[model samples]
Target: MEMNSSNLWVFIETNEKGQAHNVGLELLNPGHSLSRAQGDEVVAIVIGQHTEAAVASAEAYGSDRIIIVEGEEYARYSTDAFAYAFHALITKYAPTSILIGATDLGRDLAPRLACRLKTGLTADCTELDFDEESGNIAWTRPAFGGNLMARILCPNHRPQIGTVRPAVFKKPEQDTSHKAEIVREEIHFSIENIRTKLIEEILDADNETIDLEGAEIIVSGGRGVGGPDGFKVIQQLADALGGTVGASRVAVDSGWISSAHQVGQTGKTVRPRIYIACGISGAIQHLAAMSSSDTIIAINTDPEAPIFKIADYGIVGDLFKVIPEFIALIDEQILTMAV
Candidate 1:
């Protein structure tokens, strides 16, 4: 797998309906920047059936070109089929850098493709920048038990690959004026050749605790949340505000709450309209995930807590006192308005 161009490539993942996921389109901004720095093109590799809509989305979102791999075999994402399909495309084109969303499917496919290409892959990358000094991609992520940030580079590799968590970057503004080169590759892989068969997908009933990523307003608790009962306080505040509850890693690890509610570098990345932190000592990993929130309010007993630094509003007092008072005031206001 050798090539001449420094074209940056992105994997646009599509759902069952052939519509691209938000993360794939969100990654275009970073891809465009890297492409400009390298003086190359930004191309999106859209692999699925009836992916024309995804192709259009890629072009409008900033891709200079789009490669569509279409076949019945690709209708559903199978590891063997997608892996081989991506391997064929990359080996032929030899992109300078590749970005994949850190979804369940992508986590499986990215490493396999990187191994197939014999290239280094930076997983769960929070930042991506082109290093002019070394002429390589600089991938930054959390390391040392989420206590620090690490930047890695693969200068020797032809194509630098990275998996970025969903919602880590904001979506670029769409421009319908931009038209990308459409290159459709016919899939040659057969279903019989693949080992895994798609049974029916089991959809979980929508619950408040599980939809932290989609939550517009989140009231998250941290280490200060004493125990399992501590999360109940967090939940009450969330319920009062008509928002969802989120937890810090420490709280979740302590069995105070489920991992599904955790928010941070290792947990779900969220960019909600408003975020409220109660009794949480902010760690760098926690900030990395929720720093993008429009309005952040931190309520902790310690004035020196790291969470206060990024918070738009900081209340340095006992969360036990602050949250209960806060909820009562909110409820009172609602009742007053009803009258």
Candidate 2:
């Protein structure tokens, strides 16, 4: 493969309806920052049918150029098909670095592409930076069960690859006025080359909703919440704050709440403006998800809870007493504002 130009490449993920995911925009913020610092263009690679909307959305979020691969196989996410398409692009236009979201599809495809190109890939990265002097990328991720941060460097690889967890970075401000060049590429391989067969995809009717990953405010609970009845107080608090309710893994595992509301390394990573951890002990896994929150409030009986370390506000008291009083205060404040 001959390289004509070296730029940063970001893999944009689209939903079933061909709409771009929020994480795709989130990557653009850091991607554009790196591109500006390194004097390289940020090229987004979007694979799917009818991806012009996706491209436009990518451009709105600071993509300098967009490479679109359109085909039926590209519509449905297949690990082999996506890897082949991405590999083809890598061969055609060699990039300085490749970034992908640490979603289910990205987790499956990035490693395969790395293996095919014989390049090093850092997974679940929390931070990325380029060494100006050496022009090498430094990928930072949590290691040893999230106890320590490890910075990885791939000195020999042409395109340093990394996968970042969702919500780890802020979404770039939309620049609709910024124009971007769109490049369309055809999928050379046929259905025969694609070994995997697509079975029927079953989507739950109730599963279609806004996820907490992109939510601005999240009110979460933990084991100190007591039981299912305790969730009422959390719900009231969330309603007062105009935010969604989330739960720690302990709360979910104990049947205090559904797993969908769980926030942790094993659940979902959320970067919100406010993350209130009510009656929750902060485990390393739990911290992995909401540590990126702008403001964290920890309200628990134990003053020594680990969550207080990262919390912007630490309230040492029973949540049962704290929540109602907090809600009343907020209500009164709202009423005063109305006056």
The digit string of per-residue lDDT tens for model 1 on 90-204 reads: 8788888999999888899999999989999999888899899999989998777567889999989878999998887877899999888888877569889888987777653
Per-candidate Cα lDDT values, in order, are 0.88, 0.88
Worst lDDT run of 10 residues, candidate 2, spans: 202-211
lDDT per residue (tens digit) for residues 1-339 in model 2: 233377999999998888888778889988988888888889999998678778889999888889999998777788878898999999889898999999888899999999999999999999888777777788999987689999889989878899999999988888899888888888655767778887777764534553788677899999999999999999899989989899999998998877778898888899899999999999998998899899999998998899999999989999999999999999999999999
Off by over 4 Å in 2: 1-4, 200-206
lDDT of 2: 0.88
lDDT of 1: 0.88
Candidate maximizing TM-score: 2
